[model samples]
Target: MASMVWTRYAAIGDSFTEGIGDLHPDGTPRGWADRAAEALSTRAEGFGYANLAVRGKLLDQILDVQLPAALALKPDLVSVSGGGNDLLRPGTDVDVLAARMDEGVARLRAAGADVVLFTGVDPAGSAVIRRTRGRVALFNELLRATAVRHGAHIVDQWSMDVLRDWRCWSIDRLHMSPEGHRRVALAMLESLGVQDAGDWREPELAPLPALSRGARLLFDARWARGYLAPWIGRRLRGRSSGDLVTAKRPGLSPVGK
Candidate 1:
């Protein structure tokens, strides 16, 4: 409602928080954070927003780099979503990572901000990512505990079954599509108890069509070649897509209509 809004909002995380798959007409990204900021602007005029998320960032990077900036802004609401990148790596102890994540949330909450946390989506749709589904589940469980311990709100994307549809995913099958980002923004608002007309839980227009045996094979090959191979190469070299990239909207600015 117009009467209730977070005057200052800061989002810190990885590609999910940075709005990777959601692209603007000018080749810029306008992820869920921006959508949520716009919604807040409509309700509370002059709502200021900052997004300090970059692609390929681990939870540590988020905490080390973005957390300080978010704290400096002293936002009324802070949304933090990360650790999906960490799950992709082998031998990653997510429980330990969850503990570190809890520290970040604790810091934000201690700064007197209402913090929001997110559980990662199940990546079972992808052959390469399916192996990490259990890890994702474990991280989600730990994240729930962290939220409870810190008195933070959660977006809970892991339980949103609508995200299981491939259409909600980008070509890389990692980041969310524009439609997915839109729904996430609605979900965030709903979690904050902000009433609006948007329906984030609406079903897809049509059921996904099953691919034929041959088509499935071809698709898998293409996916592996185009996205998976490059990603693996990056990991092998300890490189990241956000190696030199900085935050898209580093400073809090008034959201435009």
Candidate 2:
């Protein structure tokens, strides 16, 4: 009987890797990387995994922090999802993002990670909040080229889910919802030649509705509920809430008042 080769996997990237937008039942961010790790563990033989993703990270930051830390683990499979912050930041040129990605891939390869997976940038649809679609396309192209040069597998999520259907995005238009992340995780597994369990179901995302005043308000409120409310609650509880004085007069206070 032939023995199966089980590979240990490690994930490195930015907020997407850290599960920034999608929240777990416990209110923790359940990014696609964690989902991918879970899927791989359940299906792949002899798989060990580690997720080393931080929030608010750009390509340079990932190259500096995550690359070194993940390389230390010497994983057989490595997945990187970044560059969104780079695209959003000022003075972020294509060449810079490309260089950082190349360096990241080289370092991972040197660290004995035989299988590398790179996620492309998601589509920027008609959402008023997101950057121009052209920039996203450029980043995806650069990432694809870099991954191919390094012999790494490319997860064309930008094309697969985001562009294929605008519904794959959250109301904020920047991040993926839990359902979107699930689809992305499955795509990553498929790219890596890993099969999913029988229980995995594809999420049916609704179309992106036209932006209306009421819808915008509701969406903004939901965003606050998911992202900001927890942080505000934590700060309020830890500090002296009494010190935070409320304005007696509404119009005389800040804009929100």
Candidate 3:
């Protein structure tokens, strides 16, 4: 993408945009979106940013709730990243979800904002495994088409080999590690044609030692018990991690203040 100018930027979505995996010293999220805003602030005279993302929200919920708030700010930008949460549910349809996302993008464009969209990453090595990967692929493709139709810039995570490295993911394996989030920030800055954007292409590290089948099973069991079970229980109870949780950054203001 060519160099762009956006002084008032707003982010909207779920945990990924909410900076769940990357944390500040005070235990608050400082994800890629925040990093990107920091870089952009250097270029604009009076840049301001807002992040309206909450954890565990569906795409429709993000669009319906967060979109209005973001538009109300009259942002020069609306970074869209969501839909992974909806795909996790058993019966969600990719086409329908894409259509819903398209509507949101259209609205953002209509509001005269530069729309930046993010694709979902590969879901390998998760409990859902192969099936989830295919669903994610389909959804990513649809998101690409949606971006094209709405003239939005896209950050394609599914095809990013940099993310395939295990070190890029957090302990939960669902969110990006701190280093990973930094890499994503660099990529975003470069995507927006920000000059002197630092390198995101880190060399892959040496692989970890292989685990025995028994040890692997033990890890899997622990993961299921610690993460998977609680997530399932929340869904069963119709509860969400974001229930009553609000965006860490709710309005456009100077980056540091």
Highest TM-score: which candidate? 1
Residue 178: error of model 2 in Å?
0.8
Better of 2 and 3 by lDDT: 3
Clashing pairs in 1: none
Q: Which model, 1 or 2, shows the larger lDDT?
A: 1
Poorest 10 consecutive residues by lDDT, candidate 2: 247-256
Alpha carbon lDDT at 19, candidate 1: 90
Q: Which scores greater on TM-score, model 1 or model 3?
A: 1
Q: Which stretches of candidate 2 lie over 4 Å from their true place?
A: 1-6, 44-46, 119-122, 161-167, 196-257
- Model 3 stretches with alpha carbons more than 4 Å out: none
Candidate 1: tens digits of C-alpha lDDT, residues 31-50 = 99989888887777668999
TM-score of 3: 0.95
> Would you list the C-alpha lDDT of every candidate in the order shown?
0.89, 0.63, 0.86
Give candidates' CA RMSD values in order: 1.6, 11.4, 1.6
lDDT of 2 by residue, 84-117 (tens): 7667545678777777788888778777675555
lDDT of 3 by residue, 1-257 (tens): 45677899999999988887899888899999999999899888999999999999999899889999999999998899999888888699889999999999999999899898888877775655446788889888988898889888888777777787768888777788988898888877766667786878765567778889999889889887888889999999999999999988899999977
Total backbone clashes of candidate 3, pairs 3 or more residues apart or in separate chains: 0
Structural similarity to truth (TM-score) of each candidate: 0.96, 0.72, 0.95
